[model samples]
Target chain A: MAEFKKADSMLEWFDQRLGVVNFVKVMMTEYWIPKNINFLWAMGVLLTVLFTFLVVSGIFLLMYYKPDVNMAFDSVNYTIMQEVAYGWLFRHIHAVGASVVFLVIYIHMFTGIYYGSYKKGREMIWVSGMLLFMLFSAEGFSGYMLPWGQMSYWAAYVITEIFGGIPVIGDELVVWIRGNFYVSDSTLTRFFMLHVLLIPLAIIGAIVFHFYALRFPHVNNEEGEFFDFDEEAKKYLAGNKKESKVVPFWPVFLSKDFFVLGFFMLFFFYLVFFHYNFAMDPVNFDKADGLKTPAHIYPEWYFLWSYEVLRGFFFEIAGVSGKDLGLMAFGFANAIFLVLPWLDRSPMVKPANQRPYFKYWFWFLMADLIVLTVYGKLPPTGANAWVGFASSMTFLALFIALPFITKAEAKKVGGK
Target chain B: MKEFKILAVIAALVGITYYGIEPYAHHIMHPEVAPADFSFKTLKNVDTTLAGNAENGKVLVEANCIACHAIDKAGYPAIMPNADAAASYGVVPPDLSSSGRIYDKNYLANFIFDPVSAMHLEGKYTPESGKQFPMPAYNWMSPQEIMDIVAYLQSVTPKVTEGKETNKATFEAACGRCHDMKYAGIQATTPKDNLKAYMGATPPDLSQYIKSRGEHYLHSFVNDPQVLLHGTSMPRVGLTEKAQEEVIAYMEEIGDSKKAERESLGIWVMLYTFVFAILAYLWKRKIWSEVH
Candidate 1:
């Protein structure tokens, strides 16, 4: 009877530790994420954090911000000068952080493209990412005018004027977007709403779908193979195939991600604490005087290439004068980037495994980017000026040629 | 499996919510969030005529002048890089309190019309014995308007005394802590970045700031100046446009006095490139981590 009582106490002790045992069992059995995921895998996690930062900061800015031209400039200055402590810091970090985010996103997308991450059933993942990119691009362009500085006003003026080149209803479309004869208070307000509210809400919804689709299959690599399970062992024991090498979702991968996040935080903090000065250009500080023209009024750095591309096609291609044609070409170039995923139809998953024609086209695209950037920096004069103009046309040709070239390369390599 | 699915959902929700708070806190700290309401309507009401119209412009002259120019001596207050009489008289405001004794209506109008032409258009000052320096012209106004100003100046009798000089000294002594080394009444055209690059700590001159900027911008600036101009270490000076136009006229009356130091664009380009390259490298590193 004493021995029986001892056994009962042992059972109680075992019961006390059931929660820990069950947790381990569930993790071992159900979770199939790979243990060998490399740094490339970190991008997915980093992107999640980045998207969150943009949304949260953007919403707060929208709270006090006015979209009207009369109020927009003052509103931004007010936000910086008198709003709240660290409000300026938040804005600067978010503004600069956005540029950083895109810089990271573009590289991540390219890396995914090069490594064959979108193959077979993984097409949805790429498509979702593309949708997210388009949403982000729209969001960036729309929010740019929120500051309502001379740059924002003129940039919107220059960019929106591009729709006038689209033939037939182009003029009407431009007017519709402007909400008046010009890009006025109404247009700014609408853009503010779209940027701060609509686009972000859509992006968040799409992110969930993107992650859901991403979960169905682990990422593919250059080899293009899947884990195979033994048929006999599966027939009696279980039907599931050899899945991803099992591991805990925390501590291992999470620790490495934390390290990368720490590094970025350090850089971001340094910029905020030491260099907290606003990007209000001297020309912008003069109160959007329509009469006085600033000697130079370039777009923010991120949009320089597109601006240069538009300027390239200004006179020669469309016979249009002034900044109109340049603006059109900029719009067209970016539109092509939005639709890139559907354009490339090479059967091989990896960039390295692509046909020679596709490979050559890719390098040409890279060269076009370099040319556009160089052209953006030059003064609009002399032989070098014309060369800058020519660079945009070259980039336009390369952009248009990409779809046809990829199709041809696929035909030569494999019909699919 | 169902319980584990529930757990994952809960975990993701909590993680995302916590992460979202970081940037939310970051955006609340901007400096320009609130602005004082400044109206153009209110500024038009301040009557600039000194001492209720009976003093006949003498009070206006006394209230405004006596800061820098002296009547007896040909010039006043000689400083380095501007030690000569030409520098003092040509650049500084002229003593118009005794104008009744020398010049006529036509002379004053012509002086107002083309002050540079009236004084031979020589620059801020001339070292030559009889060459004499010219004042900047106010071409925006008509001849009749210039005559009215001349008549107003001639009507005033000079009230030279110990008390007036002491009052002027007190005003300057108080304001001089900030305004002593101002741009000799000229409008500042220096870019903020270029200004920082050149003069290590000298504040910009606003001597002719009003005439150049005009009514609309000047009104906006005076309402809450720093909002329009970022990081203005200078405090606001209390003056209505009507009250300060003569001072503005006087500053323009002595134009082209100083030349700003120029900056090298090459150095700017180098700095921009270095920053761009560093940003690109960091982004590439982020991408590389995702690739492997």
Candidate 2:
């Protein structure tokens, strides 16, 4: 039996039973992150701040929020917005947190891409991060349905219906997922369960896995300068830190992260208070009616780029339907992010600055996503249809062109 | 410089998307429907500044308007119950108790002179279209007679109190006829089915309207719906400037009650974050100075 021996202090007693001393040393003091890393590296911690915002605000909303089709609208719009004191503030923080989380996620993802942080041994960190991104997207979409507004109802209906476009188990899959033939009370209840519980738990798991994964390869930094952590940690431990090329994760690295977080909160709370409408769609204020559809319907800004890709294929060609083909393309777009490590053949261990071809690819991908997002919000008719289709093709073409460009870049790696 | 370049690219990409594409796309999709008759330029002869004897105005209103609208504040009742009125007119006739306070004096006179033309419903309520307006034109009445009736309605309706609950009075007078405020326990006076038939769509409850339709859009659309939706059946209620403001403010009170709290709290939160940001920066500089 592991018996706790009486010690000089409570801390020493706990450290004897649990390896608290070693745990802290391993996780914080001994763990190293690159010193040369820029402020963009702070995005991961900023995402944690956003998650905390959503969780805390979500708990307050859940106290009053009903999941029924009829009651959900009143619960959110009337009880929370009107009756409960400062309910509007909680709702605003949550809605804004859900939206801004993605803004940071995209930056985090793009930052990874720019620095080739997903290269070689660090693939698991990127993969785990993408998993969290996917989980967060699900979390956001499900929570959106809890409002039971026109946009909420229809967005749910539209997204769930997209699953019906799959090949064999399509129709049945849609029914099972919705728990009804159409989006009804059952759909709302199940979505409510996933939103408040199941998916969020999964996201927590993924975030834990992501942080755990980061410990392995450690964090890749701004210039993609590789460091032997074991070797550098000794120098850091010996108090000769100037030449260590690394800093401890806790006090040294986190100081910059907290600074970035404070700055981020300034922008966040400004939107939470003054510019709230950017997150809350006006249409969502109207109670959900299955019979009535809004004149213009689209996902939130974060999902618009991928949604545009889904809507981009406007025509049926080569026997397959456009709807089915678009679904396939959308699926590919989502899955492609997880496979970036295997696709880029470049042997570079540096930022996009040091690699010319990969840098262009990164910018092109950014611009194409912007174009897709812009065209996504517009009604897919006339010129929009053509541009959206071209942009959709470009999105897919970027991934296809990845190995080709990077393979060529491998030849230039040694010269640099 | 490289980091700065990266930040520039991000800012430019975001700017082009939000400021450039988003607004442009919305402008094209939902073109700003400028108010067509904000000044009510269609009615030229509605001169409300004319003097009228309250006694004469009361007599005229009793003779004509009391048959349909119950001016209960003035001790007049409609000749029929609400159901019978709804069955006959396809909607319950609104009580005229607060007409003097809520409706603009010019609009009241114009509405009586020609119901269809005053509301710009000439396109819908035409002889060829067979869609008769519920309220018939009182064109036979002299201009002086119409003005007298309007004056009588105004005089009979009690003056809205200066500061207290004036908002509620204006809201009830302007919108209580067709819309339900379920959260406040104020059901629509007219039946939903009757309203649906009358206006081609039932008026939505106003409890969450401030949140649903933003403050600016609500003001514009309430003043004139036809500008935003060309074929909308909602008639221009023609509220006076003060009455309109009161009603919109009342909607905000019910729908967005925490607005004051939110704004006040926002100031503190913003200041806290800003101050913390500066402190964090200083701390980071000190900590990093120890690092290298």
lDDT string for model 1 (A1-416, tens) is 22322335664556455555566544433333444444555666777777777767766676667777777765655554235454554565567667656655765676566555665677788878878877877787787777776667777786788788777988999999988878788888899888877988898898888877766665554344454322322331353223323333343345555555554555544544443222333334334544445545565545666777867654544466646676667667777755556666666555444556766766566556655654564455666467767777788787677678877877877754
Q: Among these predicted structures, which one has the highest lDDT?
A: 2
Q: Judge candidate 1 against the unseen true structure and give its global Cα lDDT, from 0 to 1.
A: 0.52
Q: What value of lDDT does candidate 2 attain over all alpha carbons?
A: 0.86
Quote the lDDT for A269 in model 2. 93
Per-model DockQ? 0.03, 0.73
How high a TM-score does candidate 1 get? 0.55
Query: Model 1 segments beyond 4 Å from truth?
Result: A1-37, A222-251, A274-283, A317-332, A338-342, A351-360, A396-416, B1-292
Per-model C-alpha lDDT, please? 0.52, 0.86
What lDDT tens digits, residue by residue, belong to model 2 across residues A61-129?
999999999899998888887788888889999999998899899999998998899977999999999
Interface RMSD for candidate 1 relative to the native interface: 16.5
